[model samples]
Target: MLRSTIGGLLIAFLAFGTAAAQTYRPAFDPGALKGPRAGAPNMVMVLGTPHLSSFPESFDPDRLGGLLERLEAWGPQAIAIESLSGPQCDFMRRYPERYRDTVEDYCWDPAPARAATGLEVPAATAEAKRLLASWPEEPTPSQRRRLAAVFLAGGEQASALVQWLRLPETERQVGNGLDDVLVARLETLEGRRNENTLIAAPLAARLGHERVYAMDDHTADAAVSDKEAYGKAIMAAWDNPAVAKRKALDDALADEIGTDEGVLVLYRAYNRPVLAQLAFEGDFGAALEEPSPQRFGRRYLGYWETRNLRMAANIREMLGFNPGMRALVIVGASHKGYLEAYLDQMHDVHLVDTDTVLH
Candidate 1:
């Protein structure tokens, strides 16, 4: 009799647990559901692609080719790129001829000539160098440190050191020292540089001459410098009386972006938020859990969660700008889960499976 009672109680507990889980909707936003009409533009397709590689062995053109084919077939009126930004847009609008000339200079400059080295570099590297060189002044120490971080994250230790040295004295301090931890991190990133480039190129080729937009608002590093200041700025913008009146229109604009053009945004999977929640709930404390299930119970989960939330928010806002705009967000694989879930909650957005694309 006691065993029967225990079993019944266990079943009840399980049912209650399931109910609680169901109640937890990460993307739930009452305002998004009915706040305003999304006058969607035309068609929006969001896609996530694999990372780029230096050599053919590291490349995955077939996967990228498939994505391009889909975009071409869809025939978007204006395809926005992940590489263009608002400031650049302003520059282009204000100085079309000068902007064209600058872009041409970068594209036309021989890799060896620009870097003043005989190193056989990829087009992305060449382009990045040109862009970096053309800036008004040398990068600040913080900027150099950020570049080092990028190199470290990308597994390019040598490049990180090279970039670090190129910066002024103040910036080099940000790297601190050539410690083992920093070295190992850079080595890992160096290994992945080839892969990063290969993934970005074909997509750029396909978008050809259209309005490829760079959505990065220069906020990541800015936030790093002054988090409170950045928050205040965003808040101030939001609190402006002019902005408050246009909230509905802004929401509508987001929707329009989704329906207008097929857009893709990429992010590293190791940066997701659910993985953080899982880690906090699991054995590991605040420290980043290792990438082993036996030790960390699927260590990459938190990273994936962080990446997804960020990417989804970006996609959602961009889509809100125009309905019917198809956006393709290319991010690390682990982030796929959260992005898929978040986008699914939207009224008509479709989440394309990366596994399907990979297969």
Candidate 2:
């Protein structure tokens, strides 16, 4: 009887240990799983958080709550946001001093009554006003200085800082010609407030205004034409040896994976001479050639690759030395698809199911 009881206790101890081991797995690991290197940082918590379009009025709060809970439970040391590189972020970092009131004051706030009794504006306008009213007061000087260092550093370094600031209210009233057009579009969009992207704002806001890092390269301007030209150049460089080498490396890893599970490669769809010259002729090498947009889609795609690689490198550099760090990247969905493919082939990343997260 004594021997039997001891054996039972041992079995229970082993079972409990196994369960605890499973529960304690790190969210990200940069090591291997089967061979000698198995269990390094081989695991990465690559979640695809939604952008403005991912929210809808009918969005499942439970689903979103679950997602956020899981992420927090995963205890990711860092979160990456999509808008960290924008002017909006810059303004937030230097509010009331370098700039005026928060973006919410300019964009989300409703225009004050013009004559004490014009018909009350649309509900969308009213909502925008409410949002502006909610913005926190401007940052302190020390905060501004800290944010300046972040913005100056550029890349994920800046992102880490921007993520900590609160999101400005959506712009509603327009003060200028550009503002007028932008406001009109925003109002039109707001009427259909049932979209998931808009609904997700609260979730993003809840993720602590500062815990999320922006995951984009700050150098790229939104100028459409310039981007188009740059895209062309990248496409042209596809034939260069260095480009061949990068592609080969990506392909070799894909081959080894046996399953196209974790890599994303972005290729340019347009080629511009100036951009081509800059990417290929500059430090990046001849592989960065400009391709013809006329032949592709008349839109710049190569810029995506250049931007993504720079961002990825920054992220690696920022957190590579930190022990037990997990990262989630949010970006344009089109880019997400390509990036996922390329990242799958990387050394220590496991692509989480983006589609699952989206729903």
Flag regions of model 2 displaced more than 4 Å. Answer: 1-39, 53-63, 85-210, 222-299, 354-359
- In candidate 2, position 213 carries an lDDT of 48
Which ten contiguous residues of candidate 1 have the minimum total lDDT? 215-224
What local lDDT score does residue 216 receive in model 2, on the 0 to 100 scale?
53
Candidate 2 local lDDT, residue 53: 39
Please give me the total number of clashing residue pairs in predicted model 1: 84
Score residue 149 of candidate 2 by CA lDDT: 27
Candidate 1: residue 262 lDDT (0-100) = 16
lDDT of each: 0.40, 0.40
Per-residue alpha-carbon lDDT of candidate 2 for residues 26-91, written as tens digits (9 for 90 to 100):
767443332225444533434432232334344333433444544444444555544433333443
Model 1, residue 28: distance off in Å is 7.2
Tens-place lDDT per residue, model 1, 189-262, is 33444323323323433443211333322121111244455344434333433444334433443332231121
